[model samples]
Target: MLVSHQQNSILKHESLLVKFLTKYLSRVDSDIYFAKSSRCVTHSFTKTATVLSMANDGTLDALPVVGLAHNDDKKIPRKRVYAWAFWDWATQPFNTVLITFVWVPSFLTSTFFLDPDVVGTAGEEVALGQLAANLGAGITIAGLLIAFLAPVLGQQADRTQRQKLQLMIFTGLLVLTQLGLSFVQPGQEWFWVGVGLIAIGSVFNEIAGVNYNALLVSVSNSKTVGKVSGLGWGFGYLGGIIALATVVGLILSGVLQGDSALTFQLVALGCTIWTVFFVIPIFVSVPEPKTRQVGEKLGLWGSYVELGRSVKRLYKEARPTFWFLLASAVYRDGLSAVFVFGAVIAGIVFGFGFTDLVIFGIALNVVAGISTIIAGRLDDRFGPKNVILVAVFGLVACTTAVFVLVDLGTPMFWAVGLILAAFVGPAQAASRSFLARVTPAGREGEVFGLYATTGRAAGWMASLLWAVFIQLAGNQAIYGLLGIALVLLVGGVMLLFVKAPARSPR
Candidate 1:
């Protein structure tokens, strides 16, 4: 009877070992396997039908999971990084070709021409006031709507698994709106159409950008994020240069007459194509980030609630980022105003024609791109803050020169304008990298949303102020631009007081 009990005990112990092996193998399979095992049965089992068993197990778990990995430093290749950067390249054609180079300038000189009586009354004081007013109104309306909606869209994107889908939708909207601009003609009606398209496209572009920026964290490691961001901006400038060259070539060769509306239409079409093709890399290389809250959803109203909650959370935890946003918004708007007004100032003050303007555009693009590349390296080494401060100071000096020294036939206008363009690239790129340094993981979308909001919020202020300065100071648009310089200088000084975040490389 005692012998029979020992045999049963041994059978039970063997069965337990099989079950343990089966379960372990099922859970880990080829990714992990048992390296070794040992089992012991006490000699007392035979003497008294009392059994004691011990098992030692070892496992190899150094295998990759299907969609997950253990390494903390995984990154997409540099080729993919370049491809991702091209998205910026692709969209910039719209800014260069349609908005700045072809449309606004053409409209002001042609279809929106002031009456001789009004022109005489104003006495070369046109200042593009009507155009500026229309632009300001559109931007203000868009800015207000975006301010209410941007954070909500950002929150929804963060909480959902459909971020890539959201990006695609907004990208589509941007492309469609840009393409729609091709239908605009040289008439009063077309003026409103162009403005509407620009406003809507701007909104969609901002929304798409929020999702697109969020995708960067998944593609790059922390160490290389600044480089990738700078590359993207540099590529954008390159794309603008190419598009500007194409349009300029067409116009100068008389392939598309400057007076023909088709010239502007073709430029708009070019922008649409550029936006569509350049974003291809993003679709191919960047994977959608997985979300923990899959299948849980938020309605449009829920998105707003989430935004409110995010703001409160930001208030509690992101005070420094908020301060940075306030300063950045004012300064960035100043930067944009300089660009927006530079061309008009060149045309009115220096008498730059289409060819001259195109050449200047190319020069700015090349200089800005080079400056951005250099600034990125500097940012990685000496830090973005220092780069930004130096660039801001440069801008201040150059703008002031444009205000105080640039006159008709004055060499200073061209010299100062080119210098301003050179600084624009580095300053904008460094600001982005600076924000990247301060932002925590998983919050890029929210912070960049604030970036966009602040940029748009008071963006009209600079233009309005410029118009006011032009009207009141008469023939002193330079003084208005100089005033913009002062705002930038003040922002830069304020920036000096803020402490760099602890996580920043510097």
Candidate 2:
């Protein structure tokens, strides 16, 4: 009797094992599974084991799991979305205040004393040539350094989970550097100080931007990326406008009364404050992305080897990305040149004053903000590439009109300038969206770093070319601007040939 009972017990155990295995396998083979505890049904093979174990009170959960995989949701929540967008708002004050409006123009006018309009002499020519050389040399060195190091740093950040920390360090550097601009007194020495700060700040900005961009994947789903990106840009434009407005108010009010040099010094302080305060949101709200461990230890040489391999892979797998980069590099460089010289041309050539320049800047920002917001809808409708083409054409036309109607004074000036500003927002917003379309998953940071690098790579060249044309032509800033128009036209034509990738999500 005892032997018979033992045999029955063994049979019962075998029966339960067989039942569990069969049920698990069947669940894996089907598309749907029923979980009794959660009282919900999931339609995926990968979740079968979890459903089955839950249905059976978790006893069979330890069975060797097979065919398990994870599915990613391509959507983002609304709150985090806004927080992510605000990062751009925080950083753009640096671009507007230090680089564009106050510091650069002041450096050219005050430190160098290069008259915006040099009449009937080689004086203008020599000054422009020297300015071009200095700008070119600075950007070239910065671009080369970024190209070599950005990707490696991105890779290391991915491996080490240090992206947020890197962002903090770089952001702090940018803020400190801008604040340091306060001490740049009116002298030739100030020129060097200005250039050095610009160069270093630019480097840190690019580095931080790369890390910040990499975090996009973690912040939002693929569907919301475009909208999220547009929001960031919109916020950036708004920030720039606010900062510019404040500076203009202070200067115009005579509250900061002093020489032009002292007025500019106050403007620099405003920019520094903007940089420091705006960065607080990013530091507080944005979280670092989770990083996976690198399988093998890499020495410095190994890192270089890996980077070289990545470059090779980039060329092979991302041919479209390369072409886009090439086109973007040329056109973006031209755009930089246009803005860099816009205020100077208006003041010196068109006889615009501080009030006029401030108003123009305000108009540019307002138009650009509206255009960027509209571009999001257009991007979803006709695709980012189509919007980019339209923007590029608009850029070309406006640039040409600027030169053609050079004699129109303020009316035609504001007309053409506003039109150009309209394109600026869409072009920039669409360019970023187009890049987002082509960039591979998991590499947005390194790729955006390249984007920033490419934009800056030939920046000096464009400025140099413009300066040379103006210098050689003598009192023909219009002719120099025409050269810029040609670049935009050519870039637009080239972009037409390249096919844009299929649109996905927002």
Candidate 3:
């Protein structure tokens, strides 16, 4: 009976204190008067009840333990967000030129890695199988390495408050790595050299993206993050389109010298120049987010321990973050293989010539860029989960068509493949937005680093399946493309199991 009376008195006092703060501090520092502490709210509430009963001047001073309501939803500048989005545009060539449409399959697999002497005698099929296997192996190795490195590096970046610094250093290295590709001539020896440089560039790109994605929270709040993420992803696809067109124009006009090793080399150099020109905006404008409480300084090994603890904590307090990471990781790998093998399928299975490949790339990027931009608005309105669910389903359906209608030739690839392209960018953008929506405030770098780690951990799925299917199906590129589709199909099914928050947290 006495305890119950004391509880009532505490509740009455807390109500009176809240009313007083609401009236007096509303205009002064309402948020400061009652901000949500980083600690457990239940624990903070218990502490606040004791202070309320005391009702002393010092007790009022301790009010921050039970924050009235800190302004977590403050609007950031538009220019700062655009500056951040430019980073995606700046780096798109790494995907468009090096990994996907232009260089990987068109030139590297056909001209550089595929030896004419060996291919002529052993048959193109046998040579292509070897080339595909080697390409898959190199990429798989790089991804495995990334899985090991990304989380530790991200945690350290969070601790050191060096997201932007790390982004700049690694991104500069990525540009340098791309520029080095300009020297890769058409020869067997140069093939592995090209692969090595590309793999390194891939690593740098992933690491830099960890920081860039983390920075999203700093530039936009919950209401605008989805659109902003979509803006960045859309810019990337659009930039890829322009870059592809430029290369095609240069090659066709004799400016790049068609069929010469110099043509592809010039394309690589152009991507390098484009990266240099555009990445400047992000470095100039988006300032680094300030670091929060740096709990006991951990060494490299200790950081992993810290990461494990964070994961455990996240699972308990933020189940959405943990589940979404697993779900997105699966689908994202399939999305990656779409671009990774898109041109490969066109060049090898569909018999697209260099011009056809370049033109096809232009079309693909245009649809992807435009759809991603539209999806951004939809994401803000209908929620990122809905946007992703729709896009991923479209991808799965397109994948089935590409397989079932394999004999239809170029038209089928153009139609069904573009359908696949339309969804890839939206799903990718929404996944990033979804992560931003669930990320705990002040832990952006660590959470996003885990984001990179989770994705890279499963990165081998598409490439492995690509290699496996081709090997089993008589070294056919069509069979290899089916492997990627299977991955997407599986990922989409896995996503259905994860119960994503139906809407972005308002």
Candidate 4:
């Protein structure tokens, strides 16, 4: 009688297992069918899918699952993805040429912007130091502006379904700012104007980015978000490479003749034209969300209240994403500092010249672009959290090495700096993918807006710390490298504690 009873219990358990497997397999089949139909509207699948069973420990309940929100959404079209990625390419010159390598460092911080009496004098370095301080101050103010406005504007975009329109509007303003840069001729009188335009440009670019980043969901699903994010960043780096090479060729070919500053002015004009041409596709291709996420018709002040509520809810519900945003905000400012001050470091500390800076920019972009594309695949395989951790570790190590090995001269910088640049793209791309993986459905703009806000809220840290460290070291710029490294270290440590987002079945 006991043996018979045990046999019956075994049979009952087997029957339940069979039922569960059947239900899970049925869901898989449905997903496959949906994928196939999606490909008909998009493009052929370029990779195979991998299916993993749910974890036994219920971590899925702790972190938002990858496809939870996207399961019901229509598959995004391929053209829209390409169009959206092109926006990064379009804006590359703003970040790459104007902000980082060529324009600001080469022109605004040059002796032409200083008092004639100070140039080539004992006080020249001091004057340049003051200019650097001013630059940092301006950028800090811009960061604060972005922190205040980005989330509120992002909420409005989500509520009104006007992301594309806002993107276009800000993008146009960004272009105008770049064009205005062309008029900032060489003179102490023109110095403040250049600083103001660059600061304003930073504001426009970041606000526009809030909209662009939100559109990641519109262009990709959970399975492809990692690769798609990497692809966009890769395109930006590649575009920057091409743009840098063009500037070098023009300079070498002696095509941009006239005042030394004319070259930068023409470069600004070229970047403006590049932006106008490339930005058109996104405006034309990516459609607005079919419906608005009008949770409530909140006023501008009410929007802040709603944003607060949203933050509290995120902390309670999507804890992993909330923590990720907080951690990334700190590290990303360090990432920005890497590019924002790279040219200055090379020029002032390592004593790189015009050709050297341009060549370094080209090589850095090349390394960054290729690594980011490859890291996308790694992100999908090992998870974005792992990819980010690895990249941040590399950044902290390289940045510290640069500061310690300062006396090793230009070759050391050439070697270590490029490696540092290599990590940047992967970190940036993974952060974007990480957020896209976990953002709740239909709230892409709001979530990504908060992403921007959180980032900007801490954005002043790098610039402020860099400036402070330099001042403390008696205006020695090399010490600023340590400031950046410290931020990255803190951020990386914080990231270690944040829970990883649930993985995609694919």
Model 1 lDDT per residue over 158-204, tens place: 55655677788898999999889888766555666778888888788
Mark the regions of model 4 whose C-alpha exceeds 4 Å error after superposition: 1-62, 65-75, 117-120, 290-292, 404-408, 464-479
| Inter-residue clash pairs, candidate 2 | none
Note the Cα lDDT for every prediction shown: 0.64, 0.63, 0.72, 0.78
CA lDDT for candidate 2: 0.63
Q: Count the backbone clashes (under 3 Å) in each candidate.
A: 0, 0, 5, 0
Which scores greater on lDDT, model 2 or model 3? 3
Across 253-277, the per-residue lDDT of candidate 3 in tens digits comes to: 6666656777778778878877887
> Which pairs of residues collide in model 3?
34-67, 34-68, 34-69, 35-67, 35-68
Query: Looking at candidate 3, what is the lDDT of residue 367?
Result: 90
TM-scores, each model vs. reference: 0.78, 0.76, 0.80, 0.84
Runs off by more than 4 Å, candidate 3: 1-73, 111-120, 123-131, 407-409, 463-486, 502-506
TM-score of 3: 0.80
Candidate 4 all-Cα RMSD: 15.1
Question: Ten consecutive residues with minimal summed lDDT in candidate 1?
Answer: 62-71
Better of 1 and 4 by TM-score: 4
Steric clash count of candidate 2: 0
Model 1 error, position 207 (Å): 1.7
lDDT digits (tens) for residues 1-506 of candidate 4: 01123345433543563354335324433342233222211110111011112346663433443322343245555557668877998898998888777788778988879999888999999999898779868887887888888888888887887888889999999999988998888988898899999999999999999889988766666556776688789878877777677676767777764248878888888888778877888899987755436665568899899899889877865677789999999999899889877777998998888788789889999999878977877886778999999999899999899999888998899999889988999999999989877766556677888888898888778888999999999999999988999999999999999877655565
- On residues 1-506, what C-alpha lDDT tens digit does candidate 2 reach at each position? 01123345433543563354345324322111111111222322225334544655533322111111011232233435456655666677678866776657545434344543663466766766676568657756777777767767777665566777777888788778777767677655566666777777778778888887766645543233444456567767876776677666655676655356666666666676656655665667666754344434356677678767766666655556677877887777777667767776788778887667878888899788767765766765577678878888888888778787787878898888888887877777777767765655445555676777667665665666777778889857767777777777777777776657544322
* Index of the highest-lDDT prediction: 4
